[model samples]
Target: MDPYIRIEHLTRTYVRGTNEIHALNDVSVEIADGEFVALMGPSGSGKTTLLNIVAGIDHATSGAVSIGDQDVLAMSDARKAAWRTRNVGYVFQFYNLMPMLTAYENVELPLLVLPLTRAQRREHAQAALEAVSILTRRDHYPKQLSGGEQQRVAIARAIVTDAKVLVADEPTGNLDAESEQEIMTLLKRLNKELGKTMLMVTHDSAAAAFADRTIRLEKGRLNTKTPETAGA
Candidate 1:
């Protein structure tokens, strides 16, 4: 099968004064459809940078990134934005839910970009919330729910668009251990049952265990680590 995501000689550099910082260097990888992959590394290892590039939130200084068959790096900004809305879902470390909006409303926000009517958006949002098993908290505000509940709502919002790929950055970073387990379980379900391609950046080893493959990076280069059991 064709890879769902592909990167070729990807390099991202940031110029600070006379110094150039390479966030990624000649990095190339592929993620198959429905694959659960974890990006693991120390701080400033370029894991998040890779995620942003793949999600089209940021561009690489050199090289190419292709999602399925479309060359993401080659698209115009406007086209990239539209493609992201239709094909990518993002989950952040901090639940980026709008404080003023209720859980249901937050999930419905992404659908606004689509041609769907308000009623259709509501149905999709509600279904997403239900899929995450958080429909009961739909009427609650972010602050009104527990940390786990809030993250669940965020996941629901991410999936509301039915994006083919889900990119999560430290999704369990802010939750307690119990809540972390809950979030991991939900992500695992999304990959296994829903067949959503998932690429996650996480610091927690237990959390990385949920993925099928784990990749470690160091100083912007893919670290050479012997493959071990997922949780080992």
Candidate 2:
């Protein structure tokens, strides 16, 4: 079977005062459908750049990126924004929840862009919260929740749209050891149970171990290394 996400000769460059910076250099990778993959690298190694490009939040300087049947790099900004609303779910390192919005409200934000009725949005948002085991805290604000709980809420918001792919950038970066373990377990469950294709950028090896395979980026190039063993 073909890969769900295919990237070929992906290069992203920036011109900073006549100095050319290569954030990604001819990087090619394939991620199968429903596969849980981890991306790791040092700071400025293009891990987040790759993730942002794949998530439609950034544009590549050259090369091709195809997610399923769609040519992502070819899409117009408007088209990409529309596609992202329907197909991509992004989980940020910091919970990124609104300061005033309750967990339920935060989870429902994405649906407002769609054609769904308010009732329908509430139903889906509630379901997503339930999936992340955060239904009981739906009325709580982000400040009232623990770090792990806030991350759970963020995960709930990500899946509320029922997007085909989940792009998580350092989802556990702000949590403690115990919370990080809990978040990793939750992510593993999301990939296996919900059939969500996850592309996570993590610095923690233990966090990456939760993924089925780990790919590294060095000096903006893809590195071939033995896949880390998936943790129990």
| RMSD of every prediction | 1.3, 1.4
**Candidate 2 structure quality by residue, lDDT tens digits, 105-150:** 9999989989999899999999999999999999999999999999
lDDT of each: 0.92, 0.92
lDDT: worst 10-residue window of model 2:
223-232
Give the poorly placed runs of model 1, Cα more than 4 Å off: 228-232
Tens digit of per-residue lDDT, candidate 1, span 1-232: 5788998899999999999999999998888989888999999999999999999999899998998888999999999999998899999999899999999999999999889998899899989999999999999999999999999999999998889899999999999999999999999999889899999999989999999889887989887665634642
Residue 36 lDDT (model 2): 92
- Clash-forming residue pairs, model 2: none
